[model samples]
Target chain A: EPEVTQTPSHQVTQMGQEVILRCVPISNHLYFYWYRQILGQKVEFLVSFYNNEISEKSEIFDDQFSVERPDGSNFTLKIRSTKLEDSAMYFCASNAETQYFGPGTRLLVL
Target chain B: EDKVVQSPLSLVVHEGDTVTLNCSYEVTNFRSLLWYKQEKKAPTFLFMLTSSGIEKKSGRLSSILDKKELSSILNITATQTGDSAIYLCAVAGGGSQGNLIFGKGTKLSVKP
Candidate 1:
């Protein structure tokens, strides 16, 4: 019954500024991932994390993006400098054979 | 390129109607196909299909994977207004990065 949780359900930031989206994946899940959905586009993978290292990443996950476990429970995605195109709903998912998603953080870069 | 594609980008049906959503994929070393219901924010997990022929069901929802055809289908019978939402199909498999590839999704609207 446990669900992945994210902080700041919504965020509005100025372009070129730094932002960090936080996620607390299900306690026992092994693999963690970050995905984004543009208003009318398909959900796209950003990055995947396991064993405290990045296992895989998409082209969208450029040098500006970085992910860290930080601790036992928190997985964070930091954007070094935001861009208008970066506005989207970011979801944090945890996989345990099957994947479960968080409610998502709506990021708006203006 | 490895990708997932869904059909009938949008659908509208009466409350008592039945609807079948289709998803086809061409993912490399396909491992599993997953169905999710996205209402507003979070995508609620519905089912995961790995093998072909065998069906996985839950209540009014059922899904099956056809590896040979490189596709899958989700069936919702006796639908209700609450069934309205976007259905997403995603595939995961071999290659690097163990990430899921998603389709644009099918938008369903069940009217009461």
Candidate 2:
């Protein structure tokens, strides 16, 4: 079965630095989404992307966060000035009908 | 605001036991409810319930949705140690955006 794939399984970044988490969604998927789960917390929605634009975003997805579908398969989330609270497991998902999730990228902001 | 809540945050069962996980939600324009299993990594899709009173099953796992009650239930029969994982419930609402609102999840531990 085809699955969503993300790069940099784990990342460690200094506070105030920028980090880019990358994902390659399933080739035929039309909708893409980003969600984060703080340690011991529920998964929280961040943003959804479709047609090269943001369709929806949560409060956590503030000015510091941006998503781009720079290529056909590559979807990337960029966070500027990362904060300690930004550390979490970030998941990327794609769907035509039911959403499928990637293994996730663990971001550690120190 | 859209919200999903799961009950019995944690459960413990012995091998060959049966377990039921519950989920309830309050959301606008509810579209579908989904169940996922998380084992130290990403969540793997288990089932999706779009209509009420209809059950979806796979192997020893089955799930049913009750739109009238705004809830869903996931049942695992003859559970094994491999079944120990966090079960997450998520709801998708009708909109252009396809993001899912998730519940805190129910952790299940099956011992030998």
lDDT of 2 by residue, A1-110 (tens): 89999999999999999999999999999999999999999999999999999999988999999999997889999998999999999999999899999999999999
TM-score against native, each model: 0.98, 0.99
Which fraction of the native contacts appears in each prediction?
0.89, 0.89
lDDT of 1 by residue, B27-66 (tens): 9989899999999998999999999999999999999999
- Clash pairs, candidate 2, are none
* Stretches of model 2 off by over 4 angstroms after superposition: none
Give the Å error, residue B24, model 1. Answer: 0.2
For the predicted complex of model 2, DockQ is 0.86
Worst 10 residues of 2 chain B by lDDT: B92-101
lDDT of each: 0.95, 0.95
